[model samples]
Target: MFIKSFRPFAQSLRAPAAIILVATLAGCSTFSGFFGGSAKKPQPAELQPVVALVPARQVWSARIGEVTFPLQGNISGETLVVASNDGTVAALDTRTGRDRWRTSIGAPIAAGVGSDGKVAAVVTRANEVVALDNGREIWRQKLAAQAFTSPFVAGGRVFVLAADRSVNAFDGQTGKKLWAQQRPSEPLVLRQGGVMLAVGDTLVVGLAGRLTGLNPLNGSIRWEAPIASPRGVNDVERLVDLVGHVGRNGNTVCARAFQANIGCVDAQRGALLWTKPANAAQGVDSDERYVFGAEADGRVLALRRADGEPVWSTDLLRYRSLTSPLVVGRSIAIGDSAGLIHLLSREDGSPLNRLTTDGTSIAASPLLAGSTLIAVTRAGGVYGFAPE
Candidate 1:
């Protein structure tokens, strides 16, 4: 199921509850690589990631039923919630990879993600928020515009941002719009205690560049600061993905300037705390102490937590791609363009081990739950590794 995205995610996606199961392993050749001679070429990465491969590695592999869509993962109860490009929500027994149930709701299949104990997704054609509970639709609320930004489940309220620049807060149980805010620019991201979006009237929250701090309630201006926009060029025209993240650093709501840099702002006052040159076109990830992502030349740099300063840097890829490092315990688990997951020692960027997966990465993120390290390939393979 991996040559390319089964469906296109453009503008406001309308899902239709589609389901597709890919049994294609022809591309598995890419992993085995007849692409080049196995002379043990040391075309090194800044750090080499190591994984302990015992029979323990292959915990289990399940051929889940027809699942079409950019994949999203979540852990609920003992079930793992996965949404498919095909408009269906499914629940799988996390331990044994057994099917719990499958519920099909007519909606544009979305890469919608899961939050809390629930999965936030939108129906294909209806453009409504549908809350799913173990393969059952708890509630569905129709919206004025198409919904994007996979339903964000925070503070027990299912917060969803629409492509039309509206923040709709719904009753987590029964997809009802409890509060709605409209702003100018699209509300592309969500943070725990930070601003809501980039531009808009009633909800144009978020302070980047020089402004800082925002009120999540009304999208009001709170404070300001002098933040230097990351020094770089925007190659993707006006294509900016405002995927904001909450740094484990408490009240800091961190955002990235696509193809530019990273901005850490005061989540409370909209005050620009700091801006560090990142040049990541897609997005970034951090653990309060350091932020890691590609710089101008596809070199992954780790910057300090307090002030944005370089601590370590390494080669990530040739042209530049999107998988960000999933910082686990003492190792940095990063995915490459070739469906290879690497682990690096955090102290000094040293390669540890590598693991192979089914497809390449387009939207792969490091998954950290308890001691399990999870990596999801874009074509839809979830890998669980022990963070040695």
Candidate 2:
């Protein structure tokens, strides 16, 4: 027997009986009765011995409140900005891990930590977008719907992609609305973070399974490239939201459609390069040569950047919930649910070294700043590592 669990977007809203029934049937599957009673989850693959090929050591550590939502660590120059679910947000020096600034939003945050050095932005659970400057609250404006994706702050403006499939931009200094672009609503949306970033003068975002580019000056569509089209007979199977932490080399951007496909796009031309079947829910990272991501079963894979072809795949971490991969130097770093950071060779998927954090799930994808590698745990443990 097999059982699959699907997380709802918002837990506060209660659906009627009919809607609940339909959602349950669409989101989950079980064959317990057909078997005997229940089925056990597959055991995680045994970890290989670490060889310490990469000489890295934890340099500094810090903390905030425990992170409960999708948190994207924003990097600007030498500073890395992070936020916790309890409304605590802080800026730290990537070199020394010393606090540059620390402040709270005065309300619980749902998603955030987008910064462009001068301005920091976060979306609160109260449906408000909050902007901060040097640890002080500058302005906040109410949003129309919930946003699970971190706000993208750039070009003196803040852009938000909401769960309702709407994109809005606001003045970073005044909280005044600039423009809003709404898309056709879907029956179901993922609770996870979606892709939103800036490439040159274009604003690239993920709406459903399509990578969309818009003019940042005003809410106007520039191009829409499909990574995957919604298929299947039910809403859950048709849910194809693009996840975050995309791979970009110049104008070429690659992303993962939730459990559907992995593909790259030429953002400047608004053209898709290629897409290949990939059953993964996490996003991908890239170097100049390869795109890297972890499958739902915890297999780490690297595909060619020019064309979507598998270069290497490793199942040593299978069944262990893994975060998106981060390409650091010649190695790839990934955090697991057991709070361990695994480093593998970029040439081949071989174990290089392993590091540990407070025994909890990695709250977000690992980030790199200058020469330091940052990983945050669900228990609010922030660790900075550097080459020894």
> Candidate 1, residues 72-141: lDDT per residue as tens digits?
4555456656555556566666555556776677655544654555554544445667777656678877
Off by over 4 Å in 1: 1-56, 63-72, 76-79, 118-120, 123-126, 186-239, 244-246
Report the poorest 10 consecutive residues by lDDT, candidate 2. Answer: 8-17
Give lDDT tens digits, candidate 2, residues 259-350. 88999999889999999999877888888999999998899999999999999999999988888888889999988888999999999989
lDDT, candidate 1, residue 61? 44
Instruction: Output the number of the lDDT-best candidate.
Output: 2
Per-model TM-score, in order, reads 0.70, 0.90
Off by over 4 Å in 2: 1-37
List of clashing residue pairs for candidate 2: none
- Residue 254 in model 2: shift from native, Å? 0.5
311, model 2: CA deviation in Å? 0.8
Instruction: Please report, in order, the local distance difference test score of every candidate based on alpha carbons.
Output: 0.50, 0.82
